[model samples]
Structure formats: structure tokens, C-alpha cells
Target: MMSILKADLLKVKRKWFWLLVFLGPFGVIALQLVNYGVRYDYLMQQEPDVWAGLLDNINMFVAPALLLGMTILASQIAAIEHQQSSWKQLLSLPVQRGYVFLSKLAVAAIMIFISSTLLFIGTVFFGIGLHFGLDIPFLAVIKNSYYPFFAGIPILCLQVWLSVVMQNQAFPLAAGVFGAVFSMTAAFAAPDWIPWKWPLLVGEHDPIWYAVAGMITGSVILIAGLMDFVRREVLT
Candidate 1:
């Protein structure tokens, strides 16, 4: 598994995969920078809690960005195999088919984790730069940066599963885009069980519950996807 994972990493080293991971958080922070830059005084004056307001603004895009990123990451990873006609070659190896699927999933998850970490650091620095306060709200910052990622586990798994099973990347990519759009509207009319709504639920009174549910639901989806993957005949 470790060897397979290492090979997967090497496969994309020259593809600027890490750069994409970095861009996810960087893009989020950059947008906030522009937002705060334009109305620094106005926002600061209007916001009762500077850090809270900044976090709220940042949260607005995090879920959609995360969903889109995950979709692309998953689709790109699977596309490598499809484009190269490497699925049969990969499955013919001594390793279990499940390991290959798990390795792909791990790579996507690790990339998202790195992106989330960058988001945490970027948020702290971005907030400090804005002079929100010398006494930073570290807990709030952590939640704003990571809670959504945690809550997005189902979307990540679903994207990966869709990417891996379907040879056509368009389906997975479309699902991701639709999920991103759904996340934005979820707060108003979406049900609590909708996975797309989980990420944006960070502002809810019991946000942790949604995160936990996403993970549990994601685990089930992962298992089901793996079963189908393991049983499928690789023609290519």
C-alpha cells in the first residue's frame, strides 16, 4: 500500500499537483484579502466582532471551494489512469484492488488535508494582517478553516468514488459543481441530512454533529464504492 501510494505521488510530482493544493487555500485567502482590502474601514466599523466577521466572510466560500477542489482532484487522479490506459496494468499487480482504490482515496484526502492546513495558517496570518485583533481567536480560526473540510468528507468520498468508477470524468466533475452550488443554497432550504450542507453547517449551533455525520456517511459510501470497484472487470 505504501509503495502504491508512493508511486501515485511520483506519478503527479511533475504535474504541479502540490501547486493546485496550495492554490485552494491561497485562493480563499486571496479573495478575503480583496474583500477586506476594498472595504477595510467600512467592514471593521460595521462588524461588532472583527475576528468573527472575518471568519464569517471566509466561511462563505470555503465549502464551495473545497467541493470544487475535491472534485477536480479526484477527477484528475482518475483521469491519469484513464488517459494512460493504466487501470488494467494497475489492477494486474500483486496488490489487492481495494488497496489501489484506497491509495487513490488517500492521495485525494491528503491533498485536501494539506490544503486545509494551509487554510488554517493563512487565515491566522490574514486575520492578523488585517489588524482584527492582537488577541486572536485561535479556536474560531481553527473551526472556520477545518470544520468545513471535516464536514466535507462525504463530498470528497463521493467525488472520488464517482471519478474512479466512471471512465468519463465529466460526470464526477458535474456532480462536484452541482454540489458546490447546492452548498450555497443549502442554508436556506436544504435539509439537515444533505451532505452538501454539512460544510456550511460550521455556523450552526451544533456544527460538530454535522462533521461527525459526514464522516460516518462517508465511510459507508467508501465501503460501498470499494466493493463495486473490487468486483468490476478491468477491460482497459
Candidate 2:
């Protein structure tokens, strides 16, 4: 598993992986800048508490940007193998299929995790720049920012699974877009059972439960994806 992960890292060493990591968070922040720029006074009036308003603005865009990032990251990582038909070579190796699948999944999660961290950073940087004061809502920042990540694990797993299982990259990427849209809709109205909306469901009631559910569901889906991968035959 360690060796496989090492190889995956090296494989992405020269790719535009870092750009994907930053794009989602930066995009979200930029949108907020335009939003707040145009209506700084009006938005502040909406919240009475400017810090809360700033955080609210930041959180509003975090989930969608995160889902979109996961979609692209999954396709890009899987494309590394699909484009060159390298899956056959990978599976042909002595390593178990689970390790290969797990390593790839971990890389997918890590990329999104880094993107989430950047989301937090961008939020804080701009919040300060706006003179929201030094007394920032640090806990709210961490929870709202990172909570979406925990809830997003299952989506990351699904995205990776689809990208790996489908022969055409477009299918998996499109599935991701569909899921993202569903999640956005689910955000406004849907039960928690809809795994598509988990990212938005976080902290709606009990954050701990949401986090736990994400971990359990994501693990199951990942293992299921690996088992499926092992059962199927990769074509040359």
C-alpha cells in the first residue's frame, strides 16, 4: 500500500494536480469578494454581526465548490491510467487490487482535503482584509470549512469508483456533475439518506453523527468499489 501510494504521488508530481487543489477554494473566495465588494454594507446589515455575515457568505459557496473539485480531481487522477491504458499494467503487478484502489482513493481525498484547507485560508485572509476585526470566529471557520470535507468523503469515494470503473472518462466526470447538482438541490430539500447531500447535511443537527456516518459510508463504498474492481477483468 505504501509503495502504491508512493508511486501515485510520483505519477502526479508533474501533473497540474496543485492547480486543481487551489482552484475550488480560490474560486469560492473570488465569488465572495465580488459579493461582499458590491454589498459590503448591505451584507453587514443582514447579519448585524459582521464576522458572522462574512463566515456565512464563505460557507454558502464552500460545499458546491468542494463537490466540483472532487469531480475534477477524481477524473484527473483516474485519467492518468485511463488515457494510457495503464490499468492493465497496474493490475498485472504483484500488488493486490485493494491497495491500488485504496491508494488512488486516498490521493483523491487528499487533494480535496488540501483544497478545503485552502478554503479556510482564503476565508480568513479576506475576512481580515475586509476589516471584520481580529476577533474572528475561528471555531466556526474550522467547523463550517472542514465539516463539508468530512461529509464529502462519500462523494469522493463515489467519484473515484466511477472514474476507475468506467472506461470513458466523460461518464465518471458527468456523474460527478450530476451528483453535485443533486447535492445542491438536496441542500434545500432532502432527507439525510440521500448520500448526495451529506456535505450540506453536516452540522444541521449533530455534527459528530454526520462525521461518523460519512466515515462509515465512505469506507463501505470504497471497499465495495475495490471488490468490484477485483472481480472485473481489465481489458488491454
lDDT scores for all predictions?
0.88, 0.82
Clashes of 2: 0
How does each model score on TM-score?
0.96, 0.94
Please name the candidate that would achieve the greatest TM-score relative to the true structure.
1
**Lowest summed lDDT window (length 10), candidate 1:** 201-210
lDDT of 1 by residue, 1-236 (tens): 99999999988788877888999999999999999889988998888999889988898889889999999999998889999988999999999999999999999999999899999999998888977668998988887778888889988888989999888888899989999988888888787878899898643558888878888999999999899999999836
Candidate 2's TM-score reads 0.94
Q: Name the runs in model 2 displaced over 4 angstroms.
A: 202-204
- How does candidate 1 score on lDDT? 0.88
Residue-level lDDT of model 2, residues 149-226, one tens digit each, is 887888888889888888688888888888777776786777877777777744366755666687889889888888
Residue 116, model 1: Cα distance from true site in angstroms: 0.5
